[model samples]
Target: MTSLSTSKLLALLALFVWQAHASLANSPRSLPARDEFVCPAEDIANTGCLGPKDCLYANPNNCNTFIRCIANADGTGTPVVLPCLLELEWNDNKKECDFPENSTCPPK
Candidate 1:
């Protein structure tokens, strides 16, 4: 190929690489801020009850008001905000907090 054509091709390739790099750099590393929802205590317990689950209850007197956020499996940028609950269930194959209906867990 001609020198001019080769230089133009190289410049185009460089521009493409730079744009790709920039896009990747700006891409979010974690879940986006809008798609998440808080899971409710009842759902987390998997007891099929809407009322508070006994296993997940927190002491009102000693409970703190901090909130925990979690991301969903979808690529959409959304996270669920959960109240810091007392008892947490650990499902070996599931995420840290997996409430069937609600995404955010109730505060402990």
Candidate 2:
């Protein structure tokens, strides 16, 4: 092949490799799961603000734990509300809802 044609081919091949790598890297590792928790209506309304597909839950520990639903950003499928645990002051130590054992919060 001519030198010009060879260069074009190489460029196209490089572009393909880069695109493939990016796609693989950006692919979701796994489907996001949902967690269940209970908070007062006022707390829920104030704490975790609802987003397009996810809900923000207040993290008791960091003040950033927001429970969100797992779904594509495009908003498809049944939205599942995920439970997030926050750290609250317990005596002198920070306390959070334990997993499996204390997965769901008690009724308010």
Candidate 3:
């Protein structure tokens, strides 16, 4: 390839790398073993899920205060390290996890 073309390609590659790094840094922090789960510190009281199987009581202490625990294979509870269960987002006003689509979060 021509020297100019090579240089342009390299520059583009560098820009892509930089943008990827920035995006990752700005993204929400995921759990250690489960990356699909992201728990923001502001909305979490602890790093665990709550459910029937995981917890002796369903929705212990009104887990609604934080994220809802993940469900077991049979639909029980499994305490996870993530603040909220997968897909459930934190609702600041409601002070709990809720459906993202139903949430009143400002549009991106």
Candidate 4:
């Protein structure tokens, strides 16, 4: 009975820790607004894309963030920084967020 009670206590502790970590990660104070994130100058200068479709690029500096270039009628684009869901990374080949193991992210 004592062992069972101890196990339950440990489980509750783990649950509390996980909840706290998740809440911190999702807190507005921890992340910037989508519009507020500024793309690095290198990313802006390197985009060769032009036209109707938005372009997606992996963020070289941050595995959790990606860049999206919104196409304009004038053949220019505005770069926006975006974050992947927790524990995921940008997958350049598949053009979406994916698990880090399956992504093309360079080794840190």
Candidate 5:
């Protein structure tokens, strides 16, 4: 058997995963209707990340505000409070600022 270098092995694995994702994405049955989407049940208020990645969390107290946690080099997240534009609110399901009518959170 031929010995493959670590980089070459990782590249092959990445290619395989990418191809599988592409095929699944192109499959018609892989996606659900937008209306059928469900949001996670965990309350995300005042959340922060302990890893090296930024995180977005929903503010359960106010639909019009959301928390954007910025990742720091020390493996901590800094939470920033952000407000939605006029007539909009934070949509936890979609993870973005959205129209109030389209928001999944209860009325504030």
Candidate 6:
């Protein structure tokens, strides 16, 4: 009698553990983010304002330029804005984003 009761108790405990683990594994935080901010030419949709995840992205072909999605203040999204971060500038020859300290851009 005791053996059967103990076995049933263990089964119930195992079931409870399995349920807890399953819920956590399927939680919302485990899901992937749908919005991604692409730099320069990679604007998903020009919204003018950058989302929380928006930031400078590396471009191997343009060291001085990055693919950034800048938000427009007028509430109309139609342009692709390419602004270099801090000290970095777009380099046409390197095909990658580069810092200005180590390189100089010709006066425009």
TM-scores of the candidates in the order shown: 0.29, 0.28, 0.29, 0.50, 0.47, 0.27
Candidate 3 residue runs with Cα over 4 Å from true position: 30-108
Give each prediction's root-mean-square deviation over alpha carbons: 17.9, 14.5, 13.3, 9.5, 15.6, 17.3
Measured on C-alpha atoms, candidate 2 has an lDDT of: 0.38
Collision count of model 3: 4
Q: Which digits, one per residue and each the tens of the lDDT, describe model 2 over residues 1-108?
A: 999999999999999977864564344232243223433344334434344322333333322233332333333322222223233211112232244333343323
Put down candidate 3 lDDT per residue, 16-45, tens digits, no spaces: 977864564344432334444333332233
User: On residues 40-75, what C-alpha lDDT tens digit does candidate 5 reach at each position?
Assistant: 223223333433222665765567766655545554
Q: Model 1 over residues 1-108: C-alpha lDDT tens digits?
A: 999999999999999977864564344343233333343543434433323221232212222211222223332212222332233332223333344233333333
Off by over 4 Å in 1: 31-108
TM-score of 2: 0.28
Instruction: In candidate 3, list every pair of residues with a backbone clash.
Output: 49-79, 49-80, 50-69, 51-77
Clash number for each model = 12, 12, 4, 0, 0, 21
> What is the lDDT, from 0 to 100, of the residue 8 in candidate 5?
89
For model 6, the stretches where C-alpha displacement exceeds 4 angstroms are 30-108
What does the lDDT come to for candidate 6? 0.46
Measured on C-alpha atoms, candidate 5 has an lDDT of 0.56
**Comparing 1 and 5 by TM-score, which wins?**
5
Mind sharing the TM-score for model 4?
0.50
**Least accurate 10 contiguous residues by lDDT in model 3:** 52-61
Number of the candidate with higher lDDT, 2 or 4 = 4
Candidate order, TM-score descending: 4, 5, 3, 1, 2, 6
The positional error of residue 60 in candidate 3, measured at the CA in angstroms, is 30
For residues 23-76, could you state the per-residue lDDT of candidate 6 as single tens digits? 642342311221332233334344234563343344334444444334454443
lDDT of each: 0.37, 0.38, 0.44, 0.65, 0.56, 0.46
Instruction: State the local distance difference test value for candidate 1.
Output: 0.37
> By TM-score, is 3 or 4 better?
4
